[model samples]
Target chain A: MESPVDIQDLEIRLLLETMLHRYGYDFRNYTHASLKRRLLQCLAVCNITHISEAIPKIIHDRAFLDQLIYAMSVTVTECFRDPPFYRLLRERVIPLLATYPFINIWHAGCATGEEVYSMAILLQEEGLYNRVRIFATDINGKSLHQAKEGIYTIQNMEEYAQNYQESGGKASLPNYYHSKYDLARMHSSLKENIIFAAHNLATDNVFSETHLVMCRNVLIYFDQTLKNRALRLFDESLVHGGFLCLGTKESLSFSEISDRFTPVSQDLRIFQKKRGIR
Target chain B: MKSPHQRRAIVIGCSAGGLQALRTLLPELPPTYPLPILVVQHIPANSTGLHTTLLNHFCQLPILEANDKDPIRPGWVHFAPAGYHLLVEPNETIALSIDPKVNHSRPSIDLLFESAADVYQKGLIGVLLTGASQDGAQGLLKILHRGGITLVQDPKTAEAPLMPRFAIAIGAATKTLSLKEIGHTLKQLGADTRE
Candidate 1:
C-alpha cells in the first residue's frame, strides 16, 4: 500500500485534472508545493476529510467549484504594497509614462484592486491620470467585482496612509477617499479611467497592446513553464520602450525572455523593454 | 534511528532573537558539510536582504537568499527571502510563494517545515530555535510524524523561549539541545556523512 502522503498527492492530481476537464480552470501547471497546500486548506474549509472526497462535489456542483477555485487562487494583497516599488514608479517610471500621448496600463492578477487604485491615485497627483487608461484584470470574478467597487475597510487607512506617504505622495491619503461608517470609498475620479475585468493569464491571450504591465507577486506561484507563457504574452503586447514590473522576490535572470528586457531597477524589480527588440 | 548518511536535507526555523543564534550556529559548520540546509527566519516584509548578505559574508558555506525554482544542492544554504513562503518540491527544487502568511509571517516557519516534510519525509531533519511565536511547533510535529528527526533549541537556552517551548509541549522534539550543542551535533553529522 502507498503511504498516506503519496495517496493524498495522487488524489490532488486527480482533483486538479477533474477541475481542468470539468471547468477549464487549469491548476495543473501551478507550482506543486503551493497547489498542494491550497487544496488541503480548501479541503479543511469545506469540512472534507480527504482531498479526493471534494473531487466529486466539485464535478457535480458549480457553486462548490467556484468556492474551491476562489480559495485555491492566491490573492494576498495590500494597498500600496511594496512602498519602494511605488516610490520608484511615482518618482521615475510614471514620468516616462507621462511622456506618452496615451498609455495603456495592465494590472494583471489585480486581486481586490488595491495596487491598481494606488496607481490611479499617484497618476492623479502627477497630472497624468486623464491621459492613461488602466485595465485591471484577475482570474476570479468575485475578486473582480470587489475590485470594481473600490471600497475597503476604514481600518486599513492607517497602514495605507503610511504606505502612500512612503510611496512619496505629496497629498494626504484622505484626499483620495471618502469614509462612510466603516468603509473607505475611493474618489470616483480614480475609478473613471480604470476598467476592471476577468483575464486568465494561463489560457487567455493578450487583451491589448500596453505601455506598462504590473503583475506583482503573481508569477511566483507558477511553475517556470507557466511563468514563461505569461511572460511571452506580456512580450507580445508590450510596445517598445514600455515597462514591466514585478515583486522584489521575482527576477527575469533565469527566464527565457530576459534577453529582450533590461533592468530598469534590479533592486526594485522593474524592467524596460529593449528598444531594439520586439 | 536513521544515520547521518541517510539524511538528504536539514531545515531550521526561528524568529525573534534568531539572528544571534544563527550567527553562532551557521558560521561554525565546516565548508564541506554534506547536506543542504534550508532556513526560515522571520523578518519584515520590506527587508533589504542585508542580513542574508551579512551572514554569507562570514559563513564557511555559501549562503544565498532563495529564488524561485532554485535547485536544492548540498554544501550550500538557502534562506527564505522576506515576503515569500519557501517550499521544497519532490523534484529537489525550491519554490517560492506570496500565499497568505501563516502565523502572521510571510516566510512562515510552519509552511517551510511542513512543505519540506512532504518532500524529504524520513530523510529530513528539522530544527526549531529561539522564537516568540508558536509558528514552528506544528511543523516540527509534522516532521516527527513523518519519521524525520525533530531537533529544537532547549527553551532554557533560547533567547525567546515560547517557540521551542511550544514544540516540546506538543511532544515534537526528538532532542532539545543548546545552541552550541545543536551546532556541534550538525557538524558531527556532516563529518560522519563525509566519511
Candidate 2:
C-alpha cells in the first residue's frame, strides 16, 4: 500500500493540473516542493484533510482560489530587503542607465511593491527619476493592488531605514514616506512613474525594450522549465546592453539563456544582456 | 543497524547555538566523509552567505549554501539558505521553497528532515542538535518511523536543550550523545565509504 505522504504527492500534482486547466493560472510550472508545502498550508487553512478534498472547493469557490493563490506564491517582502543588491545597482547599473534618453525597468514578480519603491527611491536620489518608468508585475491581483497603493506597515520602516542606509542612500529613508495610523504612505512623487499590473512570468508575454528587469527571489519558486521560460522572456524584453538582476541565491550560470547575458557582478547575480544572442 | 555503505545522506537540524556547534562538529568528520551532509540551521531571513563561509574554515569537506535543484554531492556540507525550506527530491537532488515558516523559521528543521526522510527512507540518518524550539522533533519521529536512524544531542550538553529533549520525549532519537561523541559516531558510521 502506498503511504499517506505518497498519496498526498499525487493529489498535489492533480490539484496543480486542475488549477491550470480550469482557471488558466499555470502554477503547474512552479517548483513542486514549494508548491506542495504551500498547497498543504492552503488545505490546513480551509480545514481540509487532504489536497484532493480541497480540489472541489478550489474549482467552485473564487474566494478560496484567491486565497490559495496568495498563499501559494511567497508574497512576503520588505522594502530594500537586500541592501547590497541595491548598492550594486546604484554604483554600477544606474550610470549606464543615465546615459539613455529614457529608461524602463520591469519589476517582474514584484510582490507588494517593496523593491519597486526601493528602485524609485534609488532613481530619485540619483536625480534620474523623471526619465524612468517602472513596470511592477505579479500574478497575484491582491498583491498588485497593495503595490499600487504604495503603503506599508509602519513597523517595517526602521529596518527599511537601515537597509536604505546600507544601500548607500544619500538621505534618510523616512524622508521618502509619511507615517500615520500605523501605515507609511510613500510620497506621491515616487508613484508617478510606476505601473502596477498582474503578469504571470510562467505564461505572460514580455514587456518590450526594457532597460532593466529586476526579478529577484521569484525564480526560486519555478521549476527549471518555467525558470528558462521566464529567463527567455526577460532576454526578449531587455534591450541590448540592458541589465537583469536576480535575488542573491538565484543564478543564471545553469540557465538556458546563460549565453545571452554576461555576469556584471557574479556575487550579486547581476547580469547585462549581451549585444548579440550567442 | 545498516552498514556505512548503505547510508545515502545525513540530514541535520539545529538552531539557537547551531553555528557554534557546527564549527566544532564539522571539522571532526574526515576529509573523505562519504555521505552528503544536509543542514538546517534556523537563521533570520536577511542573513547572507556568512554561515557557510564561517563553517567552511573548520570543515575539510566543502561547505556550500543549498540552492534550488542542486544535485546532492558526497563530502560536502550543504547549509539550507536562509528564508527558504530545503527539501530532498526522490532523485536525491536539493530543492528549496519559499513556503510559510514552520516553528517560526523559514528553513524549518521539520520540513528538511521530513522531506529527506520521505526521499531517503531507510537510507537516511537524522540528527537533532542544540535548539530552543521543538521544530525537529516531528521530523526526527518521521525519520524514525520510516526506518531511518535518528540521533539527538544529549540534552545535558546542549546550549538550548528543549529541541533534543522534545525529540527524546517523543522517542525520536535512537541515540543521544554529547557533541564530541556525536562527531566520533559520525566518523565511525561513515568510515567504510571514505574515498
Among these predicted structures, which one has the highest lDDT? 1
DockQ of each: 0.75, 0.51
Q: Quote fnat for model 1.
A: 0.74
TM-score between predicted and true chain B, model 1: 0.97
Alpha-carbon lDDT of model 1: 0.90
- Model 1, A1-278: lDDT tens digits are 78999998889889989998998999878888888888888889879998899989988999999888888784878888888899999888988998899999999999999999899998898998999999999998888888899899989976789999898988899888999999999899999999998899989999799999999888887888899998998888899999999878788877888999999899889999999764
Output the lDDT of residue B91, model 1.
83
| Residues A213-233 of candidate 2: C-alpha lDDT, one tens digit per residue | 999889878877889999999
Residues B107-143 of candidate 2: C-alpha lDDT, one tens digit per residue: 9999999888888888889999999998999999999
* TM-score per model over all chains: 0.97, 0.94
Which window of 10 residues has the lowest lDDT sum in candidate 2 chain B?
A: B186-195
Candidate 1 — which residues are off by over 4 angstroms? B1-3
lDDT score, residue A230, model 2?
A: 93
Task: Show model 2 residue runs off by greater than 4 Å.
Answer: B1-6, B44-51, B98-100, B191-195
